[model samples]
Target: MGDVGSVGLGSLGHPLLGAVVSLASGGGVLLSGRLSLATHEWLADHAVHGVMLLPGTAFVELVVRAGDQVGCGRVEELVIEAPLIVPEKGGVHLQVEVGEADASGFREVSVYSREEADGDGAAWVRHAHGVLGSAVPSSETQYDFGVWPPVGAELVDVSGEYVRAAENGLEYGPVFQGLRRAWRRDGEVFAEVGLPEGERERAGQFGLHPALFDAALHALGVSGALAGGSGSLLPFSWRGFALEAVGATSLRVRLASVGAGSDAVSVLVGDESGRGVASVESLVLRPVDADQLNAVGGAARDGLFRVEWVDAPGAVAAGGEVASRTEVVRVVSEGPDVVGEVYGRVLEVLERVRAWVADEDLAGERLVVVTRGAVDAGDGVEDMAGAAVWGLVRSAQSENPGRLVLVDTDDVEGVGGVLPGVLALGEEQVVVRSGVVRVPRLGRVRVSGEVSGGFGSGAVLVTGGTGVLGGVVSRHLVVRHGVSRLVLLSRRGAEAEGAAELRAELEGAGAEVVIAACDAADGEALAGVLSGLPEGFALSGVVHAAGVLDDGLLTSLTRERVEPVLRAKVDAAWNLHELTAGMDLSAFVLFSSATGVLGGAGQSNYAAANVFLDGLASWRRAQGCRVCRWRGVCGPRPVA
Candidate 1:
């Protein structure tokens, strides 16, 4: 063998090096010889962290060559008789039996630098592998490759690129290993990174870890040019769609940008092949410099918040998409008692106005009551005789004519004390504390509002009646809870299949299944659908499950994944809420997931998208809307 580190013939080097060299695995014989020397020296220096040597001809040669230098009689015995030997002084080392080595070829190898020897580092590596393995296509074949550094080696330098290069080439580099590799793709991005096959099998099932998802988002910032050269950070929203469960071996991701201007959206799709998968969409805000972030106390201000338009017009007639601005305001509550008192006053006014409208409209000639403190004072009322109260009455005037009445009382004893006498003669009346009015009589009146704090029927209009999850939830509702009617809302251009499916599933369930396909996401379309509902219909529930899951990681995910999913989940939810905000409903079941709670490794981009669902749930609940955060888990069957 050549001198340790020097490639040549007839050169003497360390015995350990010679043994490493003698076996020609790849490259030139001389090159192999030199590498053997370098490997042995590297292992011996500072004691290797985790290195396992399998029993074979090469191993035997190494032992024979070590001879007297084997140190410790115990080491010699381990080399000679034991099926496996661990170098006690160095990192843990296991010498596998020759038979075992022969049965399975080397899979992949993970060489960790000395610095990554701690438990946290190990955990990170393991998590990364889970993300990578889960994304592999289901059709790939299995192979065994060597994993270097073994289990005890302290990783001095751990790189995703290095691992990929060792496995195959630069093209095969795993994206999740580090930030560098993840930022390469354009329009969309994806990566497959993880522990070798054997290692993955050893680790068991892994959930999507938040670190990995965050890293993917970081990579997206770099790839999409969202991150400025000065390293400023931007705020964004993410919506994720869960497709399947992910497990060990490989991971895949796709990414892309959707929308534009100050509020841009990025989308990411991730998969674990035949296992669990998901799609995520992130709404990114304008970049903020470090100084600005610091001034805000490391927290983003509310004004910069973007309110995703719910059922807002998509792509205005001018060709640009419509966006909504969101502002966060902080209100200091004096106390619960004060709050209650304020609300009570407001309700009392509203009730009085309603009563007045009902009493005036009894003759039923489209009576409009404009009120100013329980007296009609506004000129907006066309018919003064038909109006119950008159004279520019700002306080008693209804906000909407023929539909509302307002009665304001300065003191508790001013207008019938706490119970003001407001009458409605004909039209439906809504009363307000400051003012009230009779609302216009539309052909159909749809009641959509939110309900909280109880187990009751919640109404949700499903536009795509035939969709999978939509059908599932609807069936469950009617069969499990005896729901009276399931108004299956769809677009005017919806396919006939949807109506057929709804009829087939709900025919005899006593639930009136109305199939109307108008873009549920469109405010006008939704309004029309609501107007068409039968009289006396009261919605008790709403389930927004209409969505799609596109597969791809951060780099490879595209607008195809980002926009539709966002429109379906975030935007759709908002629109549905707007259409039903005034109606009575008990629960709003938002299908969220553990992916949002825990981010996926290679699926960093996708996981970020799903997190927005959690934010939505919190926001709705704060508004007194009963929101359910559904976290889906997987596995074998077990008795409930």
Candidate 2:
């Protein structure tokens, strides 16, 4: 980590190499620059999950420049520690320090960047470090790549390389799509990669051009490392990243697998003439988690709650101290007039629970939302808040590996009746009555089971039909379920951002699509829409898919944030239930999320809203109505 030797940069011709700092006794040279989106606009295009980042080629270019200055034509290796993030308005000051050479003639190289403050206020952060070595002349026979595609190599189309990379969480924009061709041979991957036509002429100005070198790394696309087609991986470390030749616009690359026990992969970068240009002796790749990366990347997310959902302690006797990290929502009776106050208290406590779990392991923890009232048995609407909690937590659990556990009991203090089974985290939901815990289980695997179908040719009204998931279901109903008429309702309807496109697509698919901009939460508004259905529309099916999100850990849940979300979910679902009760509908599908069943951190109200859907669905079924509670949880969102 010592400072590099100071020198002058008047002699270097590359614009990227701003100034020379010093030369070490062993002939290693240091360089510095002021990099920004202003100087290099193309760097602004490459991103990993909304975060604008300097490409890995930038590091390779720096080391290559250092190799030239220090009289060393080889770059041994470079290990990236932190990413160099270019800020919004200003550029980042950089330092490329090449260490003193060793007896075998290899120099250590490092890159650091920091924002520019008034004076010495900015702290320099090291992004990468590695070695720069001397390239000794070798007469060893180079692999015969002169013949047009190798004999045993199987040709593979790489036209959609960037798209494939994105499926694995690596979002490569146009600038970084460098893979041109790939061929898999006997245990070896061969490919030809080139830079964009616009940037090709500028490749020869630097020590080892970035776009050209970037194309070489892109050739790694055919490596088995990315064959799984899952998560994204970045180049993390390399033990020997040595460069031999200077500039090559298009690189013919050979990527070979290493021994069984090694973490490194062997690669060679050469030109069409079969001359070795650069070599990755041993490169190590690192996997990047998508959710975690988006959470910490770029600017910090704005919200008061930064809590995580931690699991609960095992079954403990009633009156015994429960684990503080456990997500324990103790439901108390709210005076009919004090609905807002009760919601405020719930939000406050949940925030603390979320923050506490930030440092704890949630794998085996249980989120016990304890409702202090009779578990609503679907006879009437009661304990709406308790139902909402189930909705919110169930939604959260789906993202956090299913950690939600719902318990309803009149006795909050004396849980001796439910302790053993409730504490174990095995049941989805349980009710405590007379010292016994009653767990509710799914009756059967209903998927693919015979559905009671009869709405093969009538109009079906769908609440929140403009949403991403709603649009999907709308199509399925028309194409698979044979619904000829449709009513798509949302607060925006045709005015929602993507509503027009959705309407066009569904209409093109042949079913009538109606965009109703009515709020489902308002009983009067929803009632009017249902009564105003056009003639010939039977309204045989009702699908409620509307919901809103106002997320906060339980602690930060205020009435203001809680009301809007609940109105969209609870009120909307209730209105739909009441309006569709007397109709002869074949299906009353309520779109509920796993959050109602699993409990999500920061989604106290969202979870509660979904819980209402579950309760209402059950209530309708009790009245001899056919209702389907679709327990749907969206894909993972970052933890609070």
Candidate 3:
């Protein structure tokens, strides 16, 4: 050890010092000869355990004179500079040698008692021995995480990479055990989980479960060390693009962080290829934290603010006092005076503007519309300004009363320079277009559309209708497709409180809705529901949206875990095809996931399930059924 080490151990008891000194000042004659009463008592108190005395012939000559006192020269040298000693022929020698007479009588020895014999006692001997003998447990066990299957088992080939990554070893048993089954290729990691093809009749194509998507995100974070970076949900917005509708047996994700600023963005891409399948760009507004990453919409939860400018020249109107008191004479020269016709035109324009205002649904919000013009008295400037102001007020009030602030251009000129035909509103917030915001709460979708001429009244059977996505699809079918009635089916009947609320929401949206609580996964239940529809009513279409996620490694996953998800999605799709056989239908839309194309880590089960749906959709399409499969890795984004 150097300076730092010496300082660190200065107060620590060193065993070597005691052993060395004990060999030197041990005998009664030597102790009496070398030490004074006070020094002897000090030596007893310090308890010197061992020491060494060297003879000149041996290795301790070459420096000291023959009569030089050992107490002063040798003893002091041994204590303060023993580390400088070096080994020599036949023995160890001090760097300096004493005279020949002194060296002959000198003896080298070591002394110890029972307590000091072992140097430091063996407190950790058992543990050290065990460590040497046994295999080391994995580092992953430091945390309370597990893998899907027990170690040393054959893995199953599910759908995509994500399911394999998550389920392969991380969730089934001990973490170390699970890691063994996973493999790393390039910069990405993959895992293989099992799928029981023997259960084919009951199973459907695998889809990417939300959990699998989330876990894949987690894996990306872990792989890139982005978990501790300055961006939260950094991968959500950027990487999703390339992964849009990919479904594969394995999912590969790549992450990159670039740019610098308060609003720096992190880009992540997921794909099975070395190139990305889906890319996400996330705008980080603040320093990343665990809470932000865990949040559904990343940092956008604060709400998105926007600025919109509307130019209105003839939309505002003057107050009643101006309109009532002001009167002007019009020169007339023909059957219809030009002044009268102009006044009529002005009135018609004002009415149209007012109607447009009244029809807007601002939800009590107000907006500001500014007009600019140089008015001449003969040009009806006062009336024109009044009409414009009135239009602005009416439009704002109708949209969302008080939400839009109406400002006159005349007022803005004093505070800032204004350009012709230019109006600026401070900031406005708009609704999220699609994804999670549009869906609202979990398991529901907010759907709005206009009803137009279409097929006559009939019930729409929406598989997974009780679920969030299904419910929204059902609402859209009823309101937009002109379906007079709806029959919603879920794995469980719609008797729960959530089902009731869904019913109310649909009813409020102007839909004649009926709830059917049946296991969409159960073909028999779905068939029975189809049979029980009101007699003579035609079927409009079916939307299959219900699905599940079973994430884990192929080696750790069990049959029970992976089968239900596939069965629910794929089986329900096929069952619906059978039940609606030969019936008049409009469109059959199947929901698939991007994971089926882009394998996801730790989501082999889910990817397998979604892949099943993709194949089933193609099969249905070939069978001459009007089927379209909407495949994508859907997350917090709104649906457009």
Candidate 4:
């Protein structure tokens, strides 16, 4: 990065990163390359929620590579736009475009990717963008250390940090485990993370080595643990982030609390010379799990929700450690009564999260709504509303990686103790009862065991029957399950485009099919439909297969996006629950998805809605009511 007055586009010859196509200088450079699992298979190891994605660090590597060609010596700032999902077959075409230097002699850099299309043309999408500048500090803002290991600083043991991180799916190899020494001075953290002798010499080749850079963040973990941070923490965004030097074997990292009102920390990195090497105005960490990262494509199930439940022998979470950097808010009160009130509180809490994430970045944080007198209360409004929370937060967690730690506890002291481990574990939820932290797991127990003889002329009500999955189910019920009488309920029942075709298909299977257009979310309308069922066609089986997908990342989601999804899943389920409770139905099957059991990214609101159904099923079972659980998946045709 020092005076590279003229380094033309020579062959990159990087074995893993691929070759650079060109590097022309207009005080900057533009290069193109082809990437694939064949060339960068190691990258597949870096995944979130079981998805093989391009890591955020890879973007930083591009900026460093760009700075090495230009005279610029550092990456001033970088912001990730969208994630790049590596394809299973074809390669991804990449472009690194650097613009001419600006007023302050800083060049803008961008990284773009377009997956090899199977049919239609695919446009280039920018994944990450940032700025590159000179290595010298524009203004020297000196920081006084006074002396090494300042007085009153607590010496924290960071020896086993990486191993624990690996257990939680971080899997930082030896190359990235850069913590050498650390100390907690007052509320500020001071640490040194040095690279191994083997990696130091190569540091001069690039503006900054990702290994060294990543290691520097180890202090943040220790600092977070000291301050009450738990679980796996991922960097969500960078603010005024800048690198001041080209090569540094070790960094003196200093992190101090921003203020009492915020969970952020101001980060300052210095070299052995005591000069600034890098500075981050503020940094935020979010709680994450394996399931939150991998919902893209069809490979979301099977491996996504791989959970391990650990039973603690002690009452309190050992030492009850938490990351000083993480934002943990404890909702100590018994929550509101109505579902509307709960949702209002949800929006209010989300607003606070939005502010913490601020700008375009997804916030990395945690919320613990601990209630003491709710459990075993037999489906009270407070408990039911709280059950809805598990779904809502789990869905949000999927969209925003490492962003939540949900804990329900009756024990008051267990609150602080379980946080560190829960935050560290990144499991969607854990309940602290009987002096143990119980991590929950989603398992598929076959609800339909050998469909015992047909419906025996009893009429079956199928909600969302006009939809693709519903039509298929209706036909299946008639042909295979011996269901002779069918009542299909959909918002656009007979008026839907494919409604007649579906009815014909079901009727062809030798069953009497009745179509009704009803909004299941409206209890009154639903009750009216149930009461007016054709005489002699008694409602025996109820299959609630209704749902809608209005997708958005948690960062972009709001009440507008969440309500429609909830009405179909949560509210509609509630209506069905109330209306059908008195009836002696053979099956009360609720059509659920992997997202409901395993929260998927971009379906935060949907996930929450589906989870409510699951909770309702359990609640009904506890009340001695018969509730059936049947799940099926259906794919759609390509949009014209």
Candidate 5:
């Protein structure tokens, strides 16, 4: 061994790794590279909840490549510790450390990275740790994808796999969409995965491109194995993995369950001509929820979004009023600042929508619901009660599509100049500020670092505190956010399934847990529970997580079916807001849903209920009240 700097670095022919060097120390090696969304654009395609991540397969590729550099062609074992997050800007400096080989010819290997902007002195976070073994034995099972699609295998539909993946927040862009075709045969699945011509041309730079390898796993989904119909699954651990060849542009894969009733699968990989490329004896995949990914992403998770008012040019009508087909219904605040009046006002707007849509004479006309300062509009809200109407109507707009529009104004007199023009433009939502017509658009919140939590040292109230979602939120608040006291409110309360266990768990974590039988939707019941807070514990926060689901298409839905869902959310939220309005609370959190933000086909009622929470949050924030709303994570639907 000579001076470390005197050792020349060598290439592993891997696109992700810059160079590999034989350490001056006995049998050691170091692999270095840099990763960024700009350079590795394909990484951006594999985003979970808007946070781009280096696919697990890429780590496998890096491990295999580093192993090959040291005459160790097999990845004996590998475990992913944390996600390798690629931020929106800047790159991460990566290092693959392969330790000195042992007497049995096995070596320790690990992958670590740090933000390039953090400079060299910054702490390096290890993403993966594994072991490398001697060269793969040549006598291993060989596969030549000779017959193509395999004889007697039934073709599996892969067209909608990516679509379904997107619905679960596993958004795969074109580069990562490599599942070309798949087949099933006698409890085993086979697939042919290939990269696009552009990506294929770059395949020579790596052992096997991650996109191609990941697509091979998509075949399991077609056969109801592993991550079938539950949630997105990511590779957690690998055992006895071996790679014989490099630069595979396309892969022919065979996946079989490790044993009966087992979620682990054994994978065999080969080239199109049937030459062995890689093999995994047992690969265990674990379910990954958005929260886990969001924690890794930190503030990078779906960056904050605000309603931006972009100028809606050409939205002025000729002489202020010209469209005869457009009808405007102005909704004024029901009364002077009342806590529960917003729910009644929203109900009135809902009925008006029902009547307008049901009327044959008005079938061709677009009903625009206008309000004064109902939306923040880059300013504060003046009409809090009228704000709930926006949420109700957005659902109506979703269910009725093209039949309704929403408009909010700061000044009634100023709106007259742009109202007709804005209506003529047929935008779904519009805001008129000082007579300047503008439409709302969503822009990503530029995040710099971690956003601090506002949890205080007082009892936090969770309305639906015993449901599946409520339980998850309660535990999360205690474990992650450090809320020391909680008042769990539900109709069944302690009688609710797992309520006792959940209370015990929270209490064990040093939290004061109060489980009370109270219907959050019932104002008197909620009031009783809130007023009965334990001695020495004052209210510090409110989390309205209570809701019931009565999912049905718009045609099959009725006001009766919708009201229960609304009572649990809309009514409960109103009760909580009113009861806690004067209290100096630190956090007023609302559990909403993506369906509310973006309507679901069979969840109009649920969507309406959750959207009301969204509107309520905005309204509360406008009133100098501390409020935070999560539109998807803690809703009726499983957090994506």
Candidate 6:
């Protein structure tokens, strides 16, 4: 196939585009390039806060060059989402994609790149997306720069121009310092920019060399318009950009405000002889900080972590072992591990915890809850029932600190030697791996792949939907995840405070809202709510946010205090799990707690209830059931 317009790949191709190939599946072109300080040495001179960045002008140049490749020479619109940081030692691979023209003769264009060191399988980071229009001729008014420093324009001091930029984190080296002089008149700023002698020789290779193009924009700072709030500003969005002429070593640039109180500006570019070179209808800039630039490539690697088991020994004095108390009460997991016996096992642990906590006579003694293979500490979980027991005791321990201890062993015999040492170590949660005691620790993890948090098209069910946390989750589902259909369940339903207003707000945002009064802990009530969903709005996700707290010290607790908390957390979660087991669900998120995992003082019942959720999630995963496929979201409230 012939190359589009005057754009081609090798000798006749652009210096930035390494290859241009028509996509096999789609009728469009995909342009690929490799960028590096070593390959593009000029890029090394353009550093922000000592961190090198691919200038936004480079994206414009790349996009325009791509437009030429597809016969779409006009950039109708472009928005830069994230910065592309080039590492000091390695390089980055980039792609410019142009889709087939639509009925309006416009094509969708996007720019993506990834670190070259991350290998071929690394996820591409999307930097910019925009539209490309037909390569039609324009009749926009052009400015005349033939007369040196035109009639009424006043010259602005350019002595401290580069110094001020450097103070704002823009470190421009020789090649990038293209602003020779600037002028101002009637709220409009005009400037003259040109490439260095060495770089000028290669200026014909690009539509407009990024350094020169960037220097032209730097003149905007003369009016303090582009000097962003708190940090330096950079171009974020561009519209109506058309390259009239290429290979211009020197440019006369005009910068005019789009409107009153608007930071956006219009630009007109011309060669040194005053001939029109390019025009931008409007360009808006956004403030950028050092962190954002440094963390650009971290999206694929962010939000990633893993649990590690680290050895923690007792704090023994020099040449002496820590004294271990001889008196220790042991509570073992006696629940059956039958796949269908989750609730039964949970109830047994609940009763045991209640009895243990209520025993004021034994309050002076430390109760050690021992289980085998309850935690995934180096080895896979063997006993799900025991894991559930661990959850229950964790809460009880939290309510009565120093009164309870948790130990998970690989075998019953392994606990004999490690039990005293575990107690002596002062670690509340310990797992015996091959007779060595180890505790859980969280560690950071980095992976190479795009992170997507989008939800599919369907209805999402949120329990306790009228409560504070539930209301927050409902709004997030509709606003952030684009959940169009929501079924909210609460005891009072619409009668709950702000429930009616929330429904209206969600409905205003194009989501169909259903607020029904139902007790999630009541299996039959929950079933009725699910069955009553309007047709075509099938449930695809569930957020079990319903929870009740009746916190108290173990000595002040009773069945009444524990039952309601369990019903809301334990029973409700189990009911949802059993009810949704056969149904296909994309997510079954149980809003559990950190208190359940690490135990919280005075919240034993609530903690135990949460731990049951942890076990249930594990059980469901083992059964290949969809409940809790993703870990539960834990927080008292969502950040604004």
Clashing pairs in 6: 395-604
lDDT of 3 by residue, 1-640 (tens): 1121122122111111111111122311111011222322211111101111121111111111111222222211111111111111122111121212223344221111111121333111100000000112212111111332223433433324333433322121111111112333333333322212332221122122222233334333233323312123222111111123323323343333332211222333232333332333331112223332233121222222222222233322222221221111111112233223223432333343334335445333333333221111112122222222322233223333333332323233231222111222222211111100010111222111111123334566777777778766765454334356777777565765477777765664345666777877677877777777776545766677888877654334455764575567655766787778777666666787655443444554565455445545544554565665662111111111
Q: Cα miss at 274, model 5 (Å)?
A: 52
Error of 1 at 347 (Å): 43
lDDT of 6 by residue, 464-531 (tens): 99888887788667544557899999999999998977787667545798899999889899898888
Error of 4 at 511 (Å): 1.3
The candidate 6 region of ten consecutive residues with least summed lDDT is 631-640
Q: Write the per-residue lDDT of candidate 1 for residues 1-640, one digit (tens) a residue.
A: 2332243233324422323222234321211122221333222211101222221222322222222121110111111111122233333211111101112221111111111122222211100000001122332212111321123322222243333322321112122233334423334443333443433452232233222333344334334343311233332222222223333344444445553222233434343332333344333333333344233321211122221212112211212221122111111123334223222332333344344445544423232322222211222221111111221112222222443332322221222221222332232332223222222222221111111122254344554556766676666555434356776754443365555746654654345666667665566777877877776455666666655555443334344544454455545566677777886666666665444332242332233234334445554555566556551111111111
Q: Write the per-residue lDDT of candidate 2 for residues 360-424, one digit (tens) a residue.
A: 56656766667754255323434555555555555445444445566777677777445654665
Candidate 5: tens digits of C-alpha lDDT, residues 1-640:
2233456776554578888787877678899998888888888888876768888899998888787777787887787767888888999988998989888899988898878876666556777777889875684445556667789999988889988888867788888888888888988888888898888888877778888888888777787754443467778777788777778888889988776544568899988777788888877676777787777753333345766789886646534673676767787775764445565666677677777888888876788888887776667666765666776677667777788888888766556567667767878888877767788777776432223354676878888888888887886676445578888888888999989878776775457889999987788887877787779668887888888888875556666886787788877888888888778777888888877655556675676677667777766665667788872122111111
Question: How does model 2 fare in lDDT?
Answer: 0.64
Scored against the true structure, residue 209 in model 5 reaches a CA lDDT of: 80
lDDT of each: 0.34, 0.64, 0.35, 0.64, 0.75, 0.74
Tell me the tens digit of each residue's lDDT in model 4 across 1-640: 2233344444553332444433444455666677788875545555544456676656776766766566664666665545677786788887777778888888777787766762225446666666777765564435654356656788989888776666666666455678888888777888888777866776775455666766776676675533225565655444456666667887777887555534446677777767777776655445566555554332321223333345543443455667775655544335443456445545655665555555444345454545442332232223555555555566666755565666767666657766776566556566766556776644333211112222334788888989988887775565335478888989987998889877765564356888999989888888988899888778877788999889887778778887888888777778888787777676677876667556677776776666666666656666666565444321111111
Error of 4 at 91 (Å): 43
Q: Which whole-number lDDT from 0 to 100 does residue 15 have in model 1?
A: 25
CA lDDT for candidate 6: 0.74
lDDT of 6 at 113: 83
Best to worst by lDDT, what's the order? 5, 6, 2, 4, 3, 1
RMSD of every candidate to native, in Å, equals 25.3, 22.3, 34.3, 27.0, 13.8, 10.0
The lDDT leader among the candidates is 5
Runs in model 1 deviating more than 4 A are: 1-460, 490-498, 601-609, 631-640
